[model samples]
Target: MSCQPQYKGQVYIWLKNKQTCLLCGETTDTPQPICTPCESELPWLGDQCGRCALPLPMADLLCGQCATRPPAYERVLAPWAYDFPIDSLITRFKHQAKWPLGRLLGQLLALSLQHHFDEGLERPDALVPVPLTTRRLRQRGFNQASLLARWLGTVLQIPCAENLLRRVQDTPAQQVLDARARRQNLRQAFAMMADAPVRNRHLALVDDVLTTGATAQALARLLLDAGAARVDVYCLARTPKPGEPA
Candidate 1:
């Protein structure tokens, strides 16, 4: 008699053997849903600013913006550039409620961060997700940043604090605003939890993507003012400057 196993479901098969890629649908050897080839081609951020993770000609060099007017966060760690498949995946996961994509992306981000930790990256005392306003939270049904931070915390063994920061203002969408406008829109937007113990603690702000970084700057400044010794920005992807290729 033939001894080939017959699986009851795709989940069982995936658990037993090969895992399917989330993007190209091809089978991948790695535990991640993305295959190695797809991952290699996924617009990984290269030669970025050490402080802001902005793509530049050299790695670890401060970008013009940071050199002139530095942001509140000490550093930024991003694994991918906001382009192509990564952008599409983030949009689907955030706007369309496609949670599977979020999970996959979170896994990938955790792996990258783990590598950073292995290479001597300083781990934060806590992971703080950029909070959404009550109105936006109600509309979206979930906070993508919080969800991603939860997954990352689970993998990295760091504490995730969803309530560390609260959104006090229901600001307009930032996508339509310029840098100055974005900064203005976020003024007094975030407040620290009165009971949270953040004084002199190193905290990392977690988010889905980094665009102009106006949001991060605002939140980091708030954390600093609240007595955080250091604030680092952590995001899955970083978008290029305006007029630059993604």
Candidate 2:
């Protein structure tokens, strides 16, 4: 049996046996909000840097930047490149408080990470989201990274520790600054919780995007300094270098 509902004069069919595609509003058998076509159309990351997940002409090679000055985190696992609908989706989810979009994206990311785990990627001991300063948390009403970490943790059966890392300073936003400036701005901005037990444990830092990786580098350094054995980044999208083709 199927039930059809009309909203704003548009008819949407709800099938008892199928789900709806969030992107195109079409009925699909896939359990996730996205249908197969929309899922395939997403900008999946490919042939990228082994360390930073930057898009590259070839696969499994460290980029020049990483080879010269390595980041604190061991590696990144970003499944998509920042492009097209993804950018729009993230903006809506982050800035517009569109919780449903964030939930959908988180679900998709969890599935992708699971595949990586099955294919030999080591699962981390804990998932720690990049924290927002109290000011930003108050302004935004919610931390997007923390929400993502919580959703991912629930799906993967990993512990989501919100207090593992703390943003001690309300640093300026990184989007307006160059890479060097961003790094300087974030220096000493993060600190680990005094009671958090991170020694010898592998941790994955969760974030919505990895642009220039300045924030992740800062947090990863903090985690390592606090005795974490390994720090890996698990972001939804990786932005290409400025002027580089996506």
Candidate 3:
């Protein structure tokens, strides 16, 4: 899959040298970005509820959350659990500017989609990245979610509409608050382009990670309000809540 290259100069060289795995600095060129040993360690999400993507027993497709209050997004498909080396790797990608890992994460997400075709995620009409506010984009130099969406669009043979969604207002980081606070903080945080060419479209909302599902839910609501027929989320990892099953 083609992606906008992020690393440059000596940092790029170090990334190439450390080809074993982005998570653990091992060695060797495995077909997958990660080495075989590291690959086994990736906490792949499996047997999840179809609606919430929460791990569930084989007979059930809806988790308690979905049963009580469904999400605006029809379904969520994530590759791995937010834990261990994967968590640390995402942290580096987001904070330390270890950007080459974006390509690796994109590849893993594609792999997950391909593996779980039964989840019913086909090639959507378009891929929409959970947008970044202008202020945050300027500070970060890039939106990590957009990076993943671009690569995912390439892999899925779908076009990515980066401009369709806009962060009209900057909100506090979701990581800093509880789920209820996160939802309250993000209320009206996103605004669709007035003339968005997204009506009746089936979209896959792409993000680097899914924490409490608040942001994805808010984005999905906006997309549906803007005439998107359906919205499915494709995230790199799903932060399993405490006491949730493995």
Which parts of model 1 have CA positions greater than 4 angstroms off? 1-17
Supply the global lDDT for candidate 2. 0.93
Pairs in clash, predicted candidate 2? none
Give the per-residue lDDT digits (tens) of candidate 1, residues 89-155: 9999999999999999999899999999999999999999999988899999999999999999999
Report the poorest 10 consecutive residues by lDDT, candidate 2: 7-16
Error of 1 at 100 (Å): 0.9
TM-score (C-alpha, index-matched) for candidate 1? 0.93
TM-score for candidate 3, please give it. 0.86
Tens-digit lDDT track of model 3 for 61-111: 787888899999998988887887788888888877888887888887877
Each candidate structure's TM-score, on Cα atoms with residue i matched to residue i, is 0.93, 0.92, 0.86
User: How many clashes does each candidate structure show, in the order listed?
Assistant: 0, 0, 0
Writing each residue's lDDT as its tens digit, candidate 2 over 1-246 gives 558554577456664457788789998668888889999999999999999999999987999999999999999988899998999999999999999999999999999999989999999999999999999999999999999999999999999989888899998899999999999999989888889999999999999999999999998988898899999999999999998877
Best candidate (score: lDDT): 2
**Candidate with better lDDT, 1 vs 2:** 2
Task: Indicate whether candidate 1 or candidate 3 has the larger TM-score.
Answer: 1
Q: What lDDT does candidate 3 reach at residue 221?
A: 91
Q: Which parts of model 3 are misplaced by more than 4 Å?
A: 1-19, 24-29, 57-59, 117-120, 243-246
Best by TM-score: 1
